[model samples]
Target: MSNTAAVRIDDTPAPAFSAAPMKIVVVGHVDHGKSTLVGRILNETGALPEGKVEYLREVCDKRGMPFEWAFVMDALQAERDQGITIDTAQIRFATQFRPYVIIDAPGHKEFLKNMITGAASAEAAVLVIDADEGVQEQSRRHGYLLHLLGLRQIAVAVNKMDLVNYDQTRFEVVKAEIVAYLNSIGVEPTYVIPVAARGGVNISENSAETAWYKGPSVLGALDLFEQARPATDLALRFPVQDVYKFDQRRIIAGRIESGRLKVGDTLVFAPTGKSARVASIESWGVQSLSAVSAGAGQSVGITLDEQIFIERGQVASLAEAAPAVSHTLKARLFWLGRNALKVGSRYKLKLATAEYAVEVIAIERVIDVEDLANHPGAEVGRNAVAEVVFRSRTPIAHDSFLDNPRLGRFVVVEDYDIVGGGVIAEAGGIHQAHKSANITEVAHKVDFETRALANGHRGGVVWLTGLSGAGKSTIAMEVERQLFLKGWQVMVLDGDNVRHGLCSDLGFSPEDRAENIRRVGEVAHLFAQAGMLVITAFISPYRADRDRVRTIHPDVFHEIHVAAELDECEKRDPKGLYKKARAGQIPEFTGISAPYEAPEAPELALVTTGKPADESVAELVRYLEANFSLTARNQTESWGF
Candidate 1:
């Protein structure tokens, strides 16, 4: 049905081109003629093999169905039977300008994951829209996704114009709607043209059906788009893959992801601040070379001048352009997990060659793709986009997504299955005492046994975590008084009192709250190390933040959950916070606007809903005395007295 002739399939090798093939992904709503358009392009460019179209036509006849251009690309039997593309298919074709690899991605919502996988690597995109149907939800979603994936070279093809009788007014209406939506999402489409893909009208040449329209055809628009520049011009980023030993030399092997590397360049391994110079470049089945230079996309092995301990997952870069080293980062994530992505859940963050155990600390906001609206939420549902914050136990090296995409992109894995993908928007600086590189920990001269013998008890931290109005400070004060009266060294670090001095500069934002907890946990650990019972009462809502404190001193950290129902806490309203939060006076108030992640397992749980304060204090005191008291058991064996 196309005006152009289709070429026959050949067995001889095809002619080689000077440049690498440009990859383009075709996407849109289902039943919008994405496959049909791709098939038309193949035929118009004479890229289809001989008898291929006839063979598919015969097959359609046998099945008692009209032959369709979509069948040219939808080669799978299941896809032909179902009349839908379930997976992505790649095909090679050439025009007068250059060769191209067109990726026909599924347009169905259920196959969006496959579409993302295909489009993530594409340099350009052709978004197909049904002219008769105007703009649909999936059409807008696909446009937003292309923008999110950083594809700017886009061409919108208004297909199925024959159904609308090739009316110029109808095509203009569809084009305007799509253009406005794409522009709102910061995507400026290079071209928007009307074409009837079924009969190949206006695919390779301008059609007379739309005499008023004067835009280029689909193939012409593609030729006008520019190719992406090579990444070799960017800063060097070489993530170490492995280290091998050959006789007396140790060879470091990895592919240069960006920029260039040469012999004698001083490279710094990130997060460790270790530097080494490249001495020689190594190659297999080739003669030894000394001053070899390598650019991006080349895998090379090099020997360091001075052998320092280096391992896989360490990124090598110049000191001036080294990646950020931090324990916390902000990301724009697309979650695909069956379970909702919530705060405090743990996942393995795989970025470049490094993998870190990361926990979600906050979900800033979830974005609705249909309306492009942002809503504050506690969790991200399946196939939703959200801005989230993640914290790792140790520092990890990475670049911002805009600075270098290779090191910025990451995937979240839960239980050995990839559940989410994202890009690092921001990397937070070191805020924890343990993360500080300049500080050195000093050891105490007096041993634990000496301090315990003098104080009559061992050092430990009693951390009470709960929602507001949970009687945490009330019970902590009472326990402190009782322990002090019994001639034991005890101190209570009430949240409000500490915030007046130590955390005076912090606000109530999620980042500031996490930092406040880190400071408090460090101070509590110090007090406990001095053989004192340090009691901390605070509304530590995030389980990940509390779990981080436990890791500081696992043996001495005692997490006590002050269990209180939300309604009861609201009814009590100790500080009038619940009332203000209800009145919309306070923002991000826990148990009202924000979230509270209860501890899955704690050292103790006290139900303070209706119980007397004295009873709760008595129970807590008994727990402490039984666990921290040196005289409760054999002191000689327990403390090595």
Candidate 2:
């Protein structure tokens, strides 16, 4: 192994001071000596109570079993009998540098759920591997789980060095294997040290048994880890728990999950678009103060300047940097339900203080934890990690996990039981439009109502979505022509035409397709506002993408599904693209390789299979006249053509 200068152990320490305790989770495979290592650390650091170790030795002696270091942490009777930890145990200890909370997580496969629960709150980790056995399957799984939980600071301890006779070559081999795997998953372990936990070699002091090894001991490696960033440094996320009315003041009560709040600060409640200013900070037991400021993790009550209808489940943040308001979001979740998690399954999502009814819209991919390979799967089995997309009927406020972990993580509840948990990878559905601080929106002189009256018709968007060869463009063009001949302003935004100019820079990737649809939707909305019928024909495959467009203007946006079977559309092959896709010339072609999620319920469904294009166009024209033509509704006589 490539060695660094030894971290000398100080025999005497200075007086300890107050500091936040850093949480660290110790994990490994079964029989890898994780608990033993934790026990040794506790004993060597003088963290154990005066008589705790003697008490444990007496209990073991009476039980007719030799005293083992693992017995120090395996406190339960079942754990002692089975020689395995079944539950997570947390113990606090203080070193000269700082106080630490060491969470001993179970290594048994059956207790992985409990391990996850324990590691979720940890900021750093210690992964234990057996020196004799090197790395095992469970070791890799635990390492991946640590990465999944977002624990970046890690230390790998090759325990039981005595079993391998303190072999330097063996330790180097194990270190190389684990280091390569961890690096593949974006984890650079802070240190990889070889130690014998049962013998207390390198637990706190250097031992002559492994004199060739020159690195910090496990405790020293831990003390070197930087503390996690304070929550107050992150964006503001105050979830309102309740509101109390005390005499004349209406006090909003909640805990600040991140950032800081003070008197006179303006707050905006999400999903409601309501704003209020903090009039006064209220405390129950304390005397009235001149100025009071609450930061992350503090619970406080405050009265607002204006009395707006505010309730629980609403998040408060600064107006300039608020959480995303969306009905759709992508998540990387680990499913723990008895039944498989499939698309279309309904569950309640608990995010921070808010609860929303969400349905799984898509299962992007199932990740194989052992090898880190992604495979397309229809459902996620128990303990499987998968990337999923969820949609709610109403908008929910949240942030990406990278932005604010407090507001970004959520749990999936079914029948009042938490079946899964995940982090929000991306927020979508309806994005809050933002402009530059110095820029302003110019108002139009001619409004939609005035333009509609002059044109004798109402303007709207007619979005046609379906398979590639479903004749959406053909029917859209004919409908536009018929409407124009009847003295109404109409235009067609065909997929190919838009790609030639407006969306020319984009490609056919899923993300690119969603962006293409978004740009077209915005343009269509602008046309509708200008009193002109805008017809868009595109193979917008994702349901969430279509829903985003409908959310732009539900009153005027009409979705027409040009229904056609995939086989029939492939046979038609109007543009000869299907042949190219089948021959491997094109990649991610919808209806062949990529997925195409048809609309569950559209405004209209026109079956164009075996039907003439002209007939479909005529039917579309009649539907528009009845729904959008204002003159047609009032006239008693028809105009002669």
Candidate 3:
């Protein structure tokens, strides 16, 4: 737990960096020799750690298979049975210079998610493109994912030269195609090696074949090439990990992404765009030095000159040009989504350790790798390349994935699951606040305890919604008054009440409706966060829109719909508005002039058409108590802002 709210402490062990081990992630399609190439390197270099070879040979022997090179890396039963790499296996090697840890990732369509996991943290990538099959869809996607993960530094291994009889034309053809795709994805390989892993050609040492190609061998690139800078080192960046308080002073701890962060140096937070001065630099559970300076790869804690509130996902910088912050942005996505990247779809975006719900407003275009141009994608209800525009629910400081990659990438999710992964090409300049969003000190004087005490119990959002006149607002007010008088910090976000004040300028269009619901949901979320029981009474009317709201909470979104019969609603005449709505007084009235999508399933149901307001309020309060903590906490989610 953090002393301050927002930051989350991860339990991953400190990286084993006493020796500054270099990591290379091997990625390519199935049967493209990713495992074979790794096996060949381990064998030729005698870098098979301990009993890897003998154990793999025995496993192969017992399994009644030939001692193929692939067996050395394919450790999982599913991979061995399928004769393919299923999961990434970490194998260490030394090349008489730097110790190398080989990351072997799968190449099949079914296992692309594993590929992402393997490459997400790699310093560099070894993209294997088959000489015979050339560049396949998976190859393109892997390249895209590498770029998204901010690992642009790459080397290509043109494998299976033996199958092409070591033909120079074949290698050149595949190399040309691979190069084109790489450039499209904004990566140019440091070098391309023509190798036959099965035949030990151009792997560790040069083979008798491929003498026609003068490029360095696969081992040569790993041994002798220079690597591009790590993303965290390209810019002066520090992602907030945790904020600790001791002796009434707060210390912020995190890794330095780039340049240098030192004690007493002035720093700015990106996305939030706030500035502060470092008071001290501490390490190893002790203060290292007063105003100490450090470079990339060091985890240090710093005390600010004063209490300038900061939280997780905020980037600290030492440069004049702070990173970009925005409300919404456009992203070019490589869809690994189980569901297609469709227009108007909602998803959860996880960047670093923070996640948010975002909607894909439009699919602008899809890249045709072969054509080398982007067209409106064939969302064809499957994962494909698409240029998507999204509107976020809150302001987020964003960087172009190509610029400062550590903060530029995102994942798309549906419900609570990850559906796609992507890199940001552009942070919507439109969303960048020309004026700052200051954190006002006067909003509420109530602390967490005060709000909790006032609420009679812990306060949260009981987001009741449905079609217009579904009795959402009416029941919500009655519920709010009941909770309020019972010593609860209760508030109702009625649709009309909001439209007249906080959302006065907003109109009733689908886009405006989405924005309206999104804005209200964010406010309610904040209210709940402050430990207040917020009753939101709005006719969200669409399942997707309601779903979008449900995906926001750090916990669960407790949705209770005020489901009422249409004829009964028309007959009640509580406000005499339903009759006027049906008589053409309203253009898009729910249950009459506009569409109303009833909740298919709700945590609690209420029939408000004929029910008394006081009675309905009593029922709502009981429902809130029972389902106050329920949220659509899908592990997979996306945030638009």
Candidate 4:
């Protein structure tokens, strides 16, 4: 973190004023007076222009209809005629505490998607309920949604109290039922007030009708609603949305999803492990500045001290608080798709600025929205919630929703439509979770030592990495042939050979390349554990990805960098890749358009630019012989093989 941006949230004092308006949403069951509550707030706060209410009354009289305060929020003619809100309508108003943007969401089952769009962005929520109708289906559904959206601060408005004779017993009965239901789903409302939106009781001020009630007014409760922890004070998490080149300088643009960033702060982009220092803060049509700190939802662009190849879908966070990197995640999903969320089905998951192909590997349990009952199911139906395990096609950078909502929540897109939304519950513990649940894992009866003794050699993998046309494949093949002749169990895993089948669906993007290397590493590890020496040849451009492979097979993995100049590799381009890359026919071609991060310290470094192929093979063989002996006599006796 930069010195200017570093500030502990606990040490900061609360501000008396806010530059940004508070965003809150009003939601509940249909015909529960949600729109009326919003309209009453607007009318009392003078948010509506003068004569607007009279104009609506005139229109209602001409049509021979009774005037309704809900008409103020139901702007669409269809909504007014049908007496239902079909979409979320945003109404801006000011309270005594601060300005607020109130979002009125639809309650119809057919329009749950619209409700999600509104609630997902709101910081707090106000759930409306009809005192006479009590708790309805939409009431329970919307309450669960508030929890899923990570909105902890909530207030309840029991409207239509006038219809129930403004009875204190009626209000308490409805409040108790709702409170119990909400508590079952882990939501506690800050305040539950009795109000008749049409009669204006307890909305702006206390009503004589509810003398038994002793809570703050609706407006007062809005002021009591605690503001969320400022993003400037949390850990820095800026997801890169785009990289722009304006004349000579490059600008990285994104909203500071959390925490603050200043000029000269060292930032690391995850899922790629690329780091850069902020050179200057950019603001359009404004005076230039050396440093800038943007809170949540504030978009800003900054130039880096060094131009690095980074694009959308990468999170830029402080190096000290780097995000989690994982290929699988456990999430609680709210399914709204037309089709059921079936296990093993694939969907595109979009979170913040990152997107990946994700699959539902396991459906843990489904919870009924109406009753909050957990039921076992293989698929989650529309308008249902479930806990599921999702495996991404590649690694993703994320945090738990409890830790950071901006980077934790994601939406599932099927056929280009957002069909589902979810919040990450856990990251990087798929295998560990499986083990903790008493699930038995199938194991191989033949141990590694016994297999190695039978093969007369130790199991291992020699990973060869370098730029394209660097003689990696040739050296690997030669080494494999020599080892086979020496009566050792040896095999060669070429990148192109495996791509023909195992990785046919993958491409050359940074994410795809990382997945490709991961798959290859897994295969090589399996071979090594089976008591066979595996040799892998690949460009493996990113050092972080190569490092991940080493972590996968710590004991058996050996990284050998086949050193060769870029010019030499280009000249020796056997597959015409360099020619294609120079002609702009291929993008992200390593050593040309894309980057190639060389290993800082490899097990063996062989210069293949001018040296003969035979000499390079001889050097590789010498190192392998010294490290991995063909004879396992000493280990055979120890293991009693």
* Model 1 C-alpha RMSD to native: 9.8
| Candidate numbers, best TM-score first, in rank order | 2, 4, 1, 3
TM-score of 3: 0.61
The per-model lDDT (C-alpha) reads: 0.84, 0.85, 0.71, 0.84
- Candidate with best lDDT: 2
Q: Please give each candidate's TM-score.
A: 0.66, 0.73, 0.61, 0.69
Query: Mind giving the per-residue lDDT tens digits that candidate 3 earns over 216-240?
Result: 6676667544445654467677878
Clashes of 4: 1
For each of the candidates, give the backbone clash count: 3, 0, 28, 1
Q: After superposition, how far is residue 49 of candidate 3 from its true place, in Å?
A: 3.4
Cα-lDDT of candidate 4: 0.84
Off by over 4 Å in 2: 1-18, 44-51, 161-186, 205-214, 235-434, 565-571, 579-586, 592-601, 633-641
- Output the lDDT of residue 187, model 3: 81
- In Å, residue 383's CA in model 2 sits off its true spot by 8.7
Can you write out model 1's per-residue Cα lDDT over 102-188, one digit (the tens) per residue?
999999988878888888778899999999998898898788778767789999999999999999889989999999999987899
Q: Write the per-residue lDDT of candidate 2 for residues 187-275, one digit (tens) a residue.
A: 89988999999999988767899998888788877877878879999878899999999898898999999999888887888766567
Model 2 residue 335 CA deviation (Å) reads: 9.2
lDDT, residue 547, candidate 3: 63
Task: Give the lDDT of residue 465 in candidate 1.
Answer: 92
